[model samples]
Target: MLMKTIFKLLAVALLFASCDDVEPTIYNGNIGQNDTFLSFSRSVYLLPVVQNQTGEVKVVFNSSTVSDVDRVYNIEVGFPEASPANPETFTVPASVTIPAGEYQGSFTIPGVDNGLVDEVVKRFTLTVTNLSDNEYMDNDTTTINIYEVCPLQADFLGTYTIQVASEPLGISAFEAGEVTLVEGDSQYERVFNATVYPGYGGNQQVTLAFACNFLNLGQSIDTNVTCDVEDDTKSLVHAPAELADRSAYDTNDDSYFELTFIEDSQSDCGSPANTVLTFTKVE
Candidate 1:
């Protein structure tokens, strides 16, 4: 009986020793030590309707957590003022998923070419919400603007009849002929380039360049002149300092170009200290 009692006591001591050798499991609510927040890849994006019909909005995690399961996120759309585009204009997904091992996810926003032009610029805002896990934080909301490619107040791309309404140079009244206003080069938009006769009896032809702001009908006509007389090409005039008076006006489906420039000191052409070149769009 004494030996049996000793054996039982030794067994209990071995059980307590085994329990002390094993480490206790500590439960931590956070998967990683660092904090993670969801953010949009870009705050603003231009939706190209011609080249790329769709725009992508990516949801990225600033810092990724050691997540065992896929993280899901919900997006909400809001219109600050009057909505320019309806809900039908965009194809927004209900939710986006960040894969188990991935830190980024994206959804596509499609642009519809409905031939509708909005007088005012339209925008829609997107925000991230309803995160699958409460451990992550939500960052800033993104705004997407949708508008048609309407540049000018009126169609100003065509031929125009350029004439010097008043020239102090005392040169004969010349028929400048039809000066074709072509679209500007790739570098410029809403700008036109043309070679017109600004001299007497169609004698001197000069390169004309002009541009108009699409948002506002503000116009700027270039007064720099390249005169090529008798196969001798030289820059006769340079752009003036003050162009506040120069402007363009569109009336009755006809655009008028009213330009005035001060000639530089290097100019050999006398008189007409302030050159005024006018243009009437040809029908």
Candidate 2:
């Protein structure tokens, strides 16, 4: 009889302990907000340099509230103080209209290749105006850049003997061996892989940009080849060594081409200036 009474007492305690209130988690903040605004999708747009081509720059308008009527907004185009875009090279629309029951719309800025120079980048600005019903967002204005490019007249795709023609600092950038040239994503570009440092494990992807008889190493590449064993900070880097007179190719000749680049461009080890490499097409 005493054991039965003890079991009943323990059951009553457990039941009372499970009855404590949890108190629902009260959220003291708003779940969402409704905002209406208009702005450009991007701050900068780069148009390709193909001849007789037209590029499109898109603008986006955003809104949270829907209406039964169309919403119209005005746009103003202007040129920056330095390196302004020529008026004849591009066209911008004065206004854009968004249909009702839509949250977004897009408009294009038509950029023509006329009057665009081969090596120069032209810039223009577009600003949103006369938006009475919607607020202008952070990126209200956007800049567009246009340039000219010469089409590839001939193919330079083949294996070639690449040699370190000029290494002023006597640091051999690569082993004089055969490297294959392949077509890049565009007609004005050719890509190859080579070891920029003597003992680097892998080859680095290198791009050569050609424009109107002018060619250069497209951009800087990280070799990951350190100068010293103890110093991880000092590494060899390669970048475009653009020589006005020498860094060029003959469009009529596909047999050979030369490229120049800077080894240890930032002088991580020392002042190793221009490293000129020659590529002779292999028959």
Which predicted model would earn the best TM-score?
A: 2
- lDDT of every predicted structure (CA atoms): 0.43, 0.62
Go through the candidates in order and give the clash count of each. Answer: 0, 1
**Model 2 lDDT per residue over 35-126, tens place:** 35444544455444666776554655555445567777787888999789887887778877777766556676666777564466567887
Q: What shift in Å separates residue 182 of candidate 2 from its native position after superposition?
A: 1.4
Top candidate on lDDT is 2
After aligning candidate 2 to the native by TM-score, how far in Å is the CA of 159 from where it should be?
1.2
lDDT per residue for candidate 1 within 134-177, as digits (tens), equals 34433446666554332244555577776766544343123445
Locate the minimum summed-lDDT window of 10 residues in model 1: 1-10
Predicted candidate 1, C-alpha RMSD? 29.4
**Candidate 2: deviation at residue 63, Å?**
28
List TM-score per model, in order: 0.38, 0.54
Off by over 4 Å in 1: 1-30, 51-63, 117-120, 132-140, 150-283
